[model samples]
Target: VGDALKDRFDGASRVMSNSDHETSVQRNDAAPHRIPRKDRYRFQLRPHNPDHKSPGVKDLVYLEPSPGFCEKNPRLGIPGTHGRTCNDTSIGVDGCDLMCCGRGYRTENMLVVERCN
Candidate 1:
């Protein structure tokens, strides 16, 4: 979903109609500022198979990032805490897989699963 949203946004700007004001802007600065270059939407998933040893599902909470978080942290791949194989899979958190950050939980290389209350 995040990837799709990004594609749509990119496409819209590419075909934007040019008007007098639009064309008057400096060539380098002319751009739709709605979605900044430095932003990524956030989504999370919970593991269908729960791991008791890891953090209880009840204690876990998904901390949503601001509109531009992805852009700010684009360099960081899917959060390592979610699991070593997180990157191989899409952003789907299911079964034993827990996402630490929307991209990768804050902690590095640790998949933090909150206990489900």
Candidate 2:
């Protein structure tokens, strides 16, 4: 990120380079990512044109779309929460109001029997 931003400014290359310092890549076990090293970061392209009737939702990777994740990927064309099931009592991102994109949710009871100690 620093390298990319620095590249935008004129003569910034003289201020810093690989020879001048050691750069560290942080490891994120919780949210691993493989970011491109330079200006190579570009929007993943679909075909030049997409067929509307196709089942593809345009994300480079398929995820059960929610506003929290989908809205962030505008160019990727993820279908944000139009027909997802949500858990109203969830404290995390799967909460009804968030995951359902405020369209609200329906409930159907299920029997969950667990062994007790």
Candidate 3:
């Protein structure tokens, strides 16, 4: 079955290629010749950069206090007391509960801190 299918596919491809409008091969009107049959595969040609690229969305890779952990430690806040110095607090959320925090607090929502100068 596979061999027969492969033969038919090759024949179809040969017919299509010969009838292609843009081919550079000049059709010879000379004596008839039996063209040997050969099995081959065809693959689509893709441009380096596709014409239509999907738009990118906001990545959750940086979201903190990951949604769903606990309730009591719900409201999340920045860690610090006074405008003394930059605290070395690293917040992390645990699986199953929304208890996300480090050093001293947790928040109900994820926090993102950025400095503008």
TM-score: which is higher, 1 or 2? Answer: 2
Over 4 Å off, model 2: 1-75, 112-117
lDDT values, one for every candidate: 0.38, 0.50, 0.33
| lDDT of residue 38 for candidate 2 | 65
- Candidate 3 residue 34 Cα shift, in angstroms, is 4.5
- On lDDT, the candidate that comes out on top is 2
Q: Each candidate's TM vs. the true structure?
A: 0.13, 0.30, 0.15
lDDT at position 40, candidate 1: 27
**Candidate 3 Cα errors over 4 Å, as ranges:** 1-24, 39-44, 47-117
Residues 25-98 of candidate 2 have per-residue lDDT tens digits of 56689997676766333333233224422223322222222345534456666666766677788977887877
Models sorted by TM-score, best on top: 2, 3, 1
Point out the higher-scoring one by TM-score: 2 or 3: 2
Name the top TM-score candidate. Answer: 2
Residue 58, candidate 1: alpha-carbon lDDT: 36
- Encode model 3's per-residue lDDT on 5-44: one tens digit a residue: 6555453311011223224334567964434343122222
How far is each candidate from the true structure, as Cα RMSD in Å?
A: 19.9, 19.0, 23.0
